[model samples]
Target: MKTLILTTAALALSAGAALAESHAQTVRLGTEGAYPPYNFLNDAGEVDGFEREVGDELCARAELTCEWVTNDWDSIIPNLVSGNYDTILAGMSITDERDEVIDFTQNYYPPAASAYAAPSEDVDLTGGVVSAQATTIQAGHVADSGAALLEFATPDEAVAAVRNGEADAIFADKDFLVPIVEASGGELVFVGDDVPLGGGLGVGLRESDGALRDTLDAAIQSMKDDGSLNELIVKWFGEDAQTFE
Candidate 1:
């Protein structure tokens, strides 16, 4: 989960309910292309992953023509307010702090725990330096904890900080970290306890787009009702991942 505080002007734009909607029938979905399983660039250099599939399905159900757009994680919300996109389908958790800047559809993915990964089991989580993507809940948690927080621009960079010994461990979404730890082939291992955070991952939109939010929320609920959303969650995050059901 990630969040960036928007400027006062950006908040003003997001709060303006009467702003002219310029996209017509096409809704542009924004995502961070580096977060695997959630969203990432495929071999074809197109946005592809769990969120992509879900987003496409939602758009189809909502009868909205949609396009995918990628942006850096740190600037995602700001860009959304700036009209770079109409919706944010990134792995964004629903939190009060974020609600002040953007509206969210009901979560498609259930609340998942955050975990720590390290090269060894003995790393001291309470006092050691832990790496996390800047502006993420994990980073906020680490900064608040007794551990020294090391911030990076991306998840890969955070993991690299641990691997290269710049940090003692990397803390991130448990769902996002699991595949990386598994593929690390024992080079990296889960450590410490899991920390549950946020309400779950949902589609983020501007307050001015309440109509669009309702449309997407209904689509997401339809998927949940038919169990297709659960199927997608398992498809990308494995059987252990949380589901709406």
Candidate 2:
């Protein structure tokens, strides 16, 4: 009887462990509320954008609930490292500099960085001038080229600066800038061909959370396969702006 009781207790413990391992809950996602059409707070202060939509779909597909926390762009990665959030749904490009600190899931969206100028400005495209935010990869591309570089704390500010003639051009990821341009009426125009910025936005996970990353990656892959990603892109970016590969 003692042996049988001990065996039963061991089985119960094993079952409990299995259940714990299978039902991880409540993934906390982080985003910068400043970047629109990706992840930003709407007028109602609720998160609404492409990334938020995709993140919600992913969470549902993965059978997990998520709570989004807003953090500054510069602090998002650091906060993730410190356990302030589990993943970043912000439209963060996967760059080597960032890769050195955190792990990213497979790219979910491709982005082209392009420079824009006010419609009235005669930007010399023949000169191949590129304006980019100083801290971004786009800036690095033109850092040594002596191109007209205009930097700003946020993409919105950069767009505004261009509209106000503070700068002749503004460079940014295509996905983030397209909507802003449309909303600005005839204030801006693309100055050059869109440049392929390597690395698409992906969910950021801690190095220790490989399992969670794998789960989210699978869900994202499924979304891509079923045309859900394209649908979301079109919904946010308009019919002609949809681009997926």
Candidate 3:
């Protein structure tokens, strides 16, 4: 009877472990709902963009179901730390500062930033215009050029400010800004060569979650190998602009 009871207890522990592992498979994804061509809300109030497509592919490849959560850009990292979500699919750059707080998956995209100005405006961004997002690395590249820096609450606001003549130009990731420019009916134009925005977008997870991070990184690699990443970029930003390498 003692032997039988011990065997039953072992089976029960094994079953519990299996259940726990199964429960740990889902990956919760987070994104900022405003940055278009990356992750933004559409007319139907659905969150659809480049990052969303990538997130879907990642989940499929990892054989995990993803639950996407949308929040303001500023709140993304905070919420990730606070357990609001497990991963950030937002176009979040993998900067060193961010790495100190969260573990990032292998980079899924490349560094690409640019400045956009009103088409009719004669702003010479070549002279260096400070970026409005001060924490962004681009701010250092153009901080001292006296090129008229404008502050904005969000990327959309920055683009609108330029469109309405409130600001001469706005700096943003090419993947995010290019779509806005093309959709703006020739109102905005690229001001200069694309700048290297340190760190491209990646899946963000807590530093403790090494296993989950590995799974996401593998999924991203699979997507790149199968051409899904390139296809999505071209679908959103045209063939010429799909430069993710």
Which candidate wins on lDDT? 1
| Ranked by lDDT, top first | 1, 2, 3
Using alpha carbons, what is the TM-score of model 2?
0.81
lDDT score, candidate 1, position 75: 97
Runs in model 1 deviating more than 4 A are 1-23
Instruction: Name the better of 1 and 3 by lDDT.
Output: 1
Query: Where does candidate 3 stray beyond 4 Å?
Result: 1-21, 24-26, 119-121, 124-135, 139-148, 242-245
Local distance difference test values of all predictions, in order:
0.86, 0.72, 0.70
Candidate 1 least-lDDT 10 residues: 1-10
State TM-scores per candidate.
0.90, 0.81, 0.80
Backbone clash count for every predicted candidate, in the order shown: 0, 0, 0
In the range 72-94, model 1's lDDT, one tens digit per residue, is: 99999999999999999889899
lDDT of 2: 0.72
Candidate 3, poorest ten consecutive residues by summed lDDT: 11-20
Looking at model 1, residue 108 earns an lDDT score of 89
lDDT of 3 by residue, 68-89 (tens): 8887776778889999888988
lDDT of 2 by residue, 1-245 (tens): 64664454345434434433587666798988877778789989988898889988887766676888898776778899999989998888888888888999888876545455555557753344445554666666656546666666666776777667666677777777776677768777666677777577778889888767767776776676668888998888778764675
